[model samples]
Target chain A: MLVVSLIAFVMFRFVGDPVDQMVGLETTLEERAKLREQLGLNDPLPVQFWNFVSKAAQGDLGISYQFKRPVAVLLSERLPATLELSFVSALFALLAGIPMGVYTALRRESFLSKLFLTVSLIGISLPTFLIGILLIFIFSVNLQWLPSFGRGQVVDLGWWTTGFLTVSGLKALILPSITLGLFQMTLIMRLVRSEMLEVLRTDYIKFARARGLKDRAIHFGHALKNTLIPVITITGLQLGSIIAFAIITETVFQWPGMGLLFLQAVQNVDIPIMSAYLLLIAFLFVAINLIVDLLYVVVDPRIRIGGAEA
Target chain B: MSDALLSVRDLVVEFPTRKGILTAVDSVSFDIGRGEVLGVVGESGAGKSMTGSAIIGLIEPPGHIAGGSIELAGERIDNLPLEAMRKVRGKRIGMVFQDPLTSLNPLYTIAEQLIETIRTHLKLSERDARERAIGLLDEVGIPAASRRIDDYPHQFSGGMRQRVVIALALCAEPELVIADEPTTALDVSVQSQIIDVLKNMCAEHGSSVMLITHDMGVIAEAADRVAVMYAGRLAEIGPVRDVIQDARHPYTKGLMGSIPTLMHDSDRLTQIPGSMPRLTDIPPGCAFSPRCPKAFDRCFSVQPACERHEDREVACLLYDEGGRP
Candidate 1:
């Protein structure tokens, strides 16, 4: 957490002087000194870092210069939106990707396998932003299937077709989620297929066949379990990238999320708000990676790395 | 007894390589009776392993049975579909592989894998399967079977893992077992322990075994009959005592001579002169002639026919004596 916080501080610090950001280069030296003194830029580096750290620990991330409010308030308000987008996209990716990968790996020479591999290759190779735009064009302008901009209002249940929590909301989320999930899904699928192929090459698979195990039992039962180590590691690394990608995805879709808030802070130069938000996202990514690493050890006990111990 | 419990007749297996079709097992044949062990011995690529794989219907891709008939207990098994083969496989035909280290799935606990094997083959409930697994584990000499069954493959030593594999194979009490180098991947002492377990277990269960290995010592100790493969063909098949005491094929004699024996102490170790040819370069007339010390003009020029004695078969010119053309 400290390292992550330092990253936020250093990222802002290296981007150049906060006083220059605040007072501008055209100001007189006396005026700049007055502004620097007012902004507390005269404080030592260690004191500034400590001040931010202590306040952040207390859940009071100081105040944003541009937004003129506590950084925590903006983050809390937008947290749900970012989470919702990430959840939706991750659901699409896992739901489609794992099975598609398993299928391609199992049926390597078949036409279905070839088709899936080709599609996954294409999905993995292209940029997510390009795919996102293509999807927006197709669904919004060309097809006119749903609203192109803006969002559905959050309301109570019974509005099945057209409320924030209803089919309209679901439809609204679908395009952006799929566009965001495409590359990740493809990447995961490719990872699974390759790992599954490696697992199949092991001697146990040959033994399974000699034992007269059914194809499903042999493929899913014997082969799949062994391949899980690499698959799970890939899943952990990809999940970190997922959180990062969700930020960009939310920005592109103009969703009312932490990502949008971060973008606004970046544009308006809301130092505390942007820095705090970035550190929080980094914290989430680290937490997620830790969770996945532990989950892998739980699933397959054989995996033991540099162990502070699970 | 039962006209042989498992009979492999004129088995021919071939694989299509990039260059051409290379025959792996050519006109090789053998059988195992109830409560019998037939050891198939040869150097690597002699098709001993391929024949074992083919009999179990586990011939991998690009390699397949070209011509053969496999009869298990009077029923033709060559045409059985994959589902039927599966039903036969853990249920009626068990297999123990060479590598004890990798034979069991490392992720799942031994109990889980064993229970799955038991339940899939037998019409047993989960509780029954669990009980049966413990029983099988205990039978294989795994101490504290109940507690240790939950441990993953890594937790067990190599011998213990191999024992676990044996227990898995015996879970269904199949009619026949194809133990392909069952003790190959164990320490020297552990090898003897495992071989002893297999011998005693099969004796009690009335399960025949087709044991494949190149170690003459294992064959001498465990097998009632021995089949020797040279290149892709069976060079000799006979009762163990006869084959070892009076091996008919020059290749078999070379192999027997090659075994470190106190009785036949040569100045240097008696080795077959040449290396076994690659499958693609197998000679037309006789694959072993180039290496055999007793090779004559007839041996090099024409393929020797497989001839049968009372309970032995030999495919060599020496066996025919004056009968060769």
Candidate 2:
């Protein structure tokens, strides 16, 4: 979370001077000074940072130069789209990867396990960009599903119901979801297989076997619990990584998410929008880390990471 | 009613190593009577624990029982496959391991783990299982048994965890209990406490025990009969008193002589002199001939067969020669 706040600070700086960009590119010197003074840009850097932070605390991220709306309002409106994509990705990763990984590990040296392991290795090695393009080709161009890109708002739901929040939104989600899921599932599968293999080697697991725990209970009850800590840790770390790649994914799918918004902010050098986006991303990274830390405590009671539990 | 509670004959366990087939346990055999305690004593790699694990079907990967027969209550257990073998582990045969810290699964509460063991084998309601858990916890001598039941494995001290393991093992009232160095990891004082609990419980329940360990003191104290293994072979098997006081086999004598006894002025307390040779490096003759002090040319050249006496079995050429080492 501290990293998140600091990213918010750094985001403000990434767009160059806000005052110069706020006014016209050809504004006169005296006009620039007046504009700067009005916007509090004339204050020292630290003071300006203080104002930015305090205003951000009150939910005002100033105004976007291009949109002319509060940055927070813009982000708040668009934030859920990225969250939806990430959620779909994370869920699919676990559902797809865990079983295959477990099967591979348990099978050990079998031909089928080798095949699955090989595929998983290939999956992990491939870049997310390559996967995104391949997915776009297979699902979008070849199959012609939902016209290739962009967040689609709802036009008709037969009743005055949730608009842009219904099937239309879900339809907009598939391409990005597959892209994120493919990347994360590959990594998670590898981790799960390796960790399960290790857990299955433990003396306690041997004891469980000796206790005549059915293979199912031994795998799920004993081995899985021991293996989940690593997968969770990897999941937490991978969230930041997933967010990083979402920039490319959001760009590819043309989804109207924070990634796309941040892309525009970077390309246009729009100070408020860029700063707000960077800060939010940074905050998300740090904040998710904190949550994962707390979750570590939840999953495995033995850990007291950062004295949080104590 | 003449059925032996546990019988193992010609048990052979081998591991494929980089060099060759390393025989970890070679034709080692014994039996336990109903309500008897059989102690298997050996050095670090003498296959004592391997024998215990093979009986419980806990021998892991890379080490396979090349050839063996294990009988529990007159039934051929070794002929049974994995699924059938699993039924014997906790239901018919129980195990308590060396380290109390590592033996119990760490994730669950003591109550949860104990109840899991009960419900897995026994047809009992949740309330009945809970009642049984509380009773077993008290039987294992834990203070505040009802309250501490909710605590995790780490919450208990080493001795307490061993007691919990003992409680778990005997909860099903298994006909055979294989305890592998159950108290070796505890403090010296706690060791006797754990052993006392085990002895008292086994005595009360009339369950046969295959106590696999290296501690001569433990073997002398608890085992009714003792089987001394050397380098994966049983060097001697006899009643505990005979085995400890008047060991007939040279390897058994070497092991017995190696233990410390106070009030005796001796050089280095009768050390075994050399380490047990590696599995791959066993001499062609008797496996222990490399380390045996009484090795003649015959003892070093050709392996001697096991000779049977009234209530003892000695595997040495000296027995064949009609001479005692």
User: Per model, how much of the real contact set is kept?
Assistant: 0.61, 0.61
Error of 2 at B184 (Å): 1.4
lDDT of 1 by residue, B1-325 (tens): 3579998888999999899999999887777888899999999999998998887788888888999888999887777987788788878888899998988887778988888888788889999999999988898899999999998888889999999988888888998988999888889988888988998888888899888988889999999999999889989999999999988788888888777778765787778887999999887677888988887778777777677976898998877869455
- Model 2 RMSD in angstroms: 2.9
- Reference-based TM-score of each model: 0.93, 0.94
Model-by-model DockQ, in order: 0.64, 0.70
Please list the residue runs of candidate 1 whose C-alpha ends up more than 4 Å from where it truly belongs after superposition.
A14-35, A155-164, A303-310, B264-266
By summed lDDT, the worst window of 10 consecutive residues in model 2 chain A runs over: A154-163
Displacement of the residue B97 alpha carbon in candidate 1, Å? 0.4
Fnat for candidate 1 (0 to 1): 0.61
Best by TM-score: 2
What is the fnat value (0 to 1) for candidate 2?
Answer: 0.61
